[model samples]
Target: MDNSNGMAKELAGFLIKHYTEQLHSIILSPDPRLHYPLLVDFAELLDDNPTLAHLLFSHPAEYLLVFDEAAIWAQKVIFKDLKQWDNASVKDYVHVRINVSGSPLECPETFPSIGRVRVKHRGILLTLKGTVIRSGAIKMIEGEKIYECRNCKHRFKVYPEVETRNVIPKPTICPSQSSKFCESTRFNLIEDNKICHDYQEIKIQENAQVLGVGAIPRSIPVILKDDLVDTVKAGDDVIVTGVLTAKWSPDVKDVRCDLDPVLVANYVRRMNEVKSGIDIPDDVIMKFKQFWLDFKNAPLKGRNAILRGICPQVFGLFTVKLAVALTLIGGVQHVDASGTKVRGESHLLLVGDPGTGKSQFLKFAAKLSNRSVITTGLGSTSAGLTVTAVKDGGEWMLEAGALVLADGGLCCIDEFDSMRGHDRATIHEAMEQQTISVAKAGLVTTLSTRTSVFGATNPKGQYDPDESLSVNTTLSGPLLSRFDIVLVLLDKKNPEWDAVVSSHILAEGEKENDNCNEDLKSTWPFPMLRRYIHFVKRNFRPVLSKEAENVISRYFQLQRRSATQNAARTTVRMLESLIRLAQAHARLMFRNEVTRLDAITAILCIESSMTTSAIVDSVGNALHSNFAENPDEEYAKQEMLILQKLCIIDEFPDLKSNLQ
Candidate 1:
């Protein structure tokens, strides 16, 4: 193990060589148990590739290797080995369980996949495993014991439920019709002297066995590093094998080893890379442009991305992958996830309502991005998301936030509306200007927060036809106007259309669906979009043509006419958004000059939103003008008498006022 022995270098080289050979081949095996050893080997191999090691591991201290499949398997195996796998001790065991509640309805034949189990610990940490378990599930288990299976609506007795409920169920063994409990339910183990082994105890159904306990695989251990830990110890990814543990409070479970980290890391890193130079055929682009043009004119509300296959491409646009793809082409290494590394044109923002596939899309895009996608909800404050002072090396060093973690990539934000006003406001300049100005702890520094942001928010309580959207009703106007494309979601509504829509949604699930090709044709495919983005990026220098400039000017002038004299500048923001979008369009064409087509396309999009806003403004103004005048009783009476004389008063005064 001595440095002079060259053992570490040899080990690293061997790993790199073996992994390099496997790189071009497919691992085919979906099992994580088979993959962990390769991940470990890959990490060990990277030791010789310092650049790769630094990219893979942020810190080199102690690492606590954990596997989800192993933890699950260990619990199951341990329980099976026990005299009473279904006893109070087993019931009190902690682990992750699938949530089969709401999922069963949408997927009747298959159980819905509820996410992971997380242990409550305080520290910074990195994890590479399967998807995360839901937070609500953890909270629910910590507070309760026995729970009903939301999927089957079956109630089972366990340790935590035993303490709070009147009875404890006895364990039974059966292969089919297994007894189940809520995945999040947790409990405590206790003994009663008053009751003997069989004194009035509830028993599990005859021939019924526990659910999913015998199904998990064995665990694999990897190195856990201490220096890599964060203040908020996040979750880890692992494989588990054995008897499944009963859910318990503070849901922290230990996983035993089988596979190593070598395989897993390799697969993850490969899958996480930003794919580039995706050459889509011209016919595909032409079809995409056609559908997009059609969809633009008749764009519906609430699901524009779903009008076709555009969601995937749109999703990619917000991902840090876009930045990484750009960076890789530029030949940069020793990369950091902090958003500060990139320049102004790289940042992106997506603002929309629920069910727009914003969250789902963001998650997918983040994983694909080269830069890490750090996420936080609106409830998260500015200090928590950006730069903060932390004690490092015995002195305070500025710690990076989500933006920092996503520097060369993207920052996907959900529930943007739920963020505090101040926190939300702080991001305005960062979004437009692409730089974060931090002034705290006697340190005033401007970090390059050139991170693309994919943000989603719900519309105000109701969609109003006519009203100036209050900042509370949605994001502030300034923020809303900042996106390169304010693509509205407006799917057509029809009671009879539900069956057709559901059919398409379900068909999208099946590989053999007839409409799949049609669906793919309606939008720009991901490959094409990536190529388009790449093309624009390659030709960065843009010029405004006289014709295009005239068109842009004409659109701005028209928009100004629509605005009040005092609000002339208001339209400028929209103009800026149009220009940026036009630039992207020009980039897609690989042209240095903005063409009339680009300008026209930008104007069309702007006009669509402007038209809707105009309707809202007109109706709102009329409504306010008619009713806002008569607040006092005397004034109200006078107005009512005058209205009556003018034949405008009606039984439903509110409606009458609104109409007026």
Candidate 2:
């Protein structure tokens, strides 16, 4: 084996030992039929560790990480293994005869027919391991062994003989169907001249082993010699397995999952020698592996994918989605897309304590691609995430803020709660509507800011024990509802948890300082993230369905009817949000169909946010209004002042006369 292979083997062995030692202690479960001790090596293989070659060779495809699909396969394998091990003993006789499907079979050359097997154990027959039951196989006949009782001279099948001395062999005292057997002789002859012995069933299990080299894992796509563009069809499952390249679009201005066919083909061809399974070159694998590790270790790829797909020009300033610590604190490792891909809507929020890395993720995302923009909720002009007025070559130029810049990518907003309340009012228009129209500077310029926003904020006072419900916090209901996901972060004291956090932090720290400021020079890992983000945006686009359209329309109509003001604007904004969210969900699912479910889900998310905002605002507004304008309270205060004057008058009557 080459150096890479040697390394893979060593890594795989280490992982196997590590997993086996920790399996019982951990909650890790294994299937009786399939080996789970092999998973550690499987993960190592994906890591492309050369030491995992032995495990890979035996069950290469089985352990290949296919994400969601792999989990399902593992579950099934575990169930099958457990079943086989539950009933392992009872193979005492080399050629034991058993009745199956109305036919007698010994050593079971073929499986008992499906119908027969179902009938044997009340429609749930248990078969031994390696039992092959053909469709036409028959059940065995009963009463093969029988004997005549010597005492009664009556023929009967002896299943469990009682006393051997009192009973005769062969023609007397049948041993085939009796519950008792004779005790006189060790072996008793039944009517059919067959000898019978008492035997009990025992369960047996064997360690799962590979009979031969397993199939190549689906996750590891082999580089085919053929050009995918020339040979692959639209629906064909072609794995290009090529290195990513930089490709930008002015229209999207963000890093989306798009690939330049030319770039892809070029990269694929340059990876190694074509048309050979000899082995992936160490140099080539190492370069890609490093890239993969870097991408995985950082949030660059995930954020870039979102940014590139949404906006590209102002991708700078927005942070990437690399807040692993924040995610853990929120009790979420991975969140399901909010029904957008299938039905069409989703909302996500990022809430955290100070220094929880939320700001970093947003800023990284903004700067990673040309498509994203960054904004904050500090004291600023109201409406539109970022709108500025300036002279434009002899005319007033209406400049758009981070939201507009992130038209197609992502809008990374920091200090979201710190934004002015009036300015917050303006976002209600752009967030849902996808466009920011400025009716100022004597110019009616509407900038298209159809972006996915990843907003970060800290809670007021302290983190609450119950965060799911809305309370008096800096984050308003209107804004919170816009997000399909609500993630929160808090500090931890657990060592194990801290180790995981440290691993991520160390990985990120060691990376090149891509984003450096005077005091804090930290790398955001945007360049690498941009590549992955662009890849996803390019390849993932789901179409909206008519059914989805109907659902959204009805939802909008309802929202409009319920809204106190700007009903049409709110409806339209929510509509756009639903569409974008649906598209994102579809991309995540790797599907092209934007079903009705996706639209409904999108509607639900939008409505939830809108309703919550309306409630909170109404309550606050009612309180302010009632307290601000109360005629009765004012009269009461005047009356109290008059009474105090009268009481003072009596005591100071003479003093008042002198003053007069």
Candidate 3:
């Protein structure tokens, strides 16, 4: 470490030996894709030399420079020895970039949360993970330049200071060989001799689920240079490995200037999948398998057992819980012949009044997701719901809103009815197309919002069965149609329901909960439930079977043929929702093929949300629906009755078909 030239030489040798094949392809191949700041796995370096790798943690800047020089040196040697050179400009492209992964850093204990980083951690190498909330403009900066002293005519190479870039310190005295008397401080800058790299700035915030309850998620600004610029955008979940450093704040009138902590990223890696960080062990998978095996004949019962864990504090909302599970375990996304992507992520709306546990479900659903964002509708603007363009340091930066930040996971919006009509309308594209298109402040781009939206709203005045959802919730019909399932949780004053709820509450209070755990002795705990949801979502991508397709098709055809004002709502979107919800149920049942059961469950879920249908109107309230002793028998009877009713409606068109 003390001998800089020797260390550079040693690292060059390491690169030449370990990365010969990758280098050969990059340099010698016919592909025009230029590789800049060549990537080297830190884990590989650690395996090759523990001492040097460990030194990299403490003295990153010093060794990073060495690595960059070594990379360029190795490339020159490669071209000269291999005689593969045509243009001399090709050798200037190689620079070193170390990607940090597979280390103690990845372990939960050492994983650096942005909020937990302290002053003592500065200058030490660490990998911080978060979702990119704001990405600044990419601009070039001066790297190194040659200067000529005006008085002594002495030439010297100068590099920008690491702590204060864009600054080239002047030498007090010129060292113009044999002219020791020339004490000139003046220097002429050689603009053409400077080396500049692409530079960018991005801000990332900690994941709310990872920070636990009641903890405020903190955001940090990251500095990206060269090839790292433009590699990440707003809404990306990335792991940045870099040395923690402090940058001097700009002077402001009547304000104190202090150093602001910033992360100078060495390597930035995006987590393509949101829940990729979660590690579900083999034992837990086996436990889930055993639970299903124990109730193989009663699979719906096993599924209900898992459902009971979701918002357990709230009593008896079977339909709501089932919809929550299906929304979390979304259907499979597919691309059509036109290359337009159909989103599989389903959106749910919980319309309830006065302490029906709508907010509790929102909070609990946030916990179930690995990545989630919780915000109230009262003050949420269109900017926060999607993407916001803000002026930061005189430049327009795109800051990701809740939907964008919660990409690939879930976004829970409470008090949905309280939001402004314009704000609610902004999320229509995000809910259905799963993307947010931004054209503001001269910045135009599209950001993916592939997240299921779980919103809780209250209906206007008393709940009305005859009124459309648009009138009841004050949301437009077009906006309401975007939601795959909308469950109304009206708190009706029912004596029998109230009596049972009170008794259940009393029994729950009496039962001692010191030994309460997941499987207390049957229900899954939060961790197990979270693991199962994450596992099923990643592992299962169910396709529609012949029977499922037929069942779904018949229901859609029925909805279209029915003479009702709600017919406008039953466009191709309703059919798409049917397919998505069916696929989700198949995943919930741990199957790759959607069956008739999945199709019916999907229909029932959709029926629970429908205002008026062409078959049955008394499907019962979703709030009072509870787990039946034989749910299979119940759903079977319901399905057959639906088929028989459809036949009857076909025979007589005056039935005014309404499947409640």
Q: Best candidate, lDDT-wise?
A: 3
Q: lDDT by residue for model 2 over 435-548, one digit each (tens)?
A: 567776676556555556667777776765444324524656576555554545544454765564455455445545443222122222334334433443445457777756
Clashes of each: 81, 135, 9
Q: Across residues 1-660, which tens digit of lDDT does each residue of candidate 1 receive? A: 133134334333443354433221212223322212222332342444554334223321111121222232333333333443223122211111211122211231221111222222102122223211110101112222333443454443343222222234433421124455334323323333222111111001110011254443222222111111121111112221111112122212463422111111111221122223345577855754564476453322111232223343332222222222222222111123774332334333333345545566566555544344445565468866666665421334454556644554567777767788888887887676666787766656776665567665656565554654343246666776555443334333545444655565777768777667665664545555545444445435566777667666665765676664214224565666556556655554445677765665455444434424321222111101111212233334433443343233464457377557
Candidate 3 weakest lDDT stretch, 10 residues: 651-660
- Model 1 off-target regions past 4 Å? 1-309, 312-353, 364-376, 392-394, 471-474, 490-492, 496-500, 509-513, 521-532, 564-571, 611-660
Off by over 4 Å in 2: 1-348, 390-397, 467-472, 503-529, 543-585, 593-660
lDDT value for model 3: 0.80
> Judged by lDDT against the true structure, how good is candidate 2?
0.38
TM-score of 2: 0.33
Give the alpha carbon lDDT tens digit for every residue of 1-660 in model 3.
Answer: 348778877887889989876666556645443446678988888888888888887788778878877876777667666664654333455667777776655764335699988887787777889888899988877777787889867787776654563465666666665536676778887777657777888998887766676888998889998778899888788899887887766666787877778888888888865455589889988987887789899888878888888888777899999999999988889999999999988999989887888888888998888878889997689998898989876689889999988888889999888888788889988888888888999999999998999998989998888887777888787877888898887777899999988876666665565433332455668998899988888898898887778778888888888837575367788888989999999888878899878988888898888877566853778888887777767775687677665553343233224433
TM-score of 3: 0.88
The Cα local distance difference test for each model comes to 0.39, 0.38, 0.80
Report the Cα lDDT for residue 187, model 1. Answer: 30
Best-to-worst order by TM-score is: 3, 1, 2
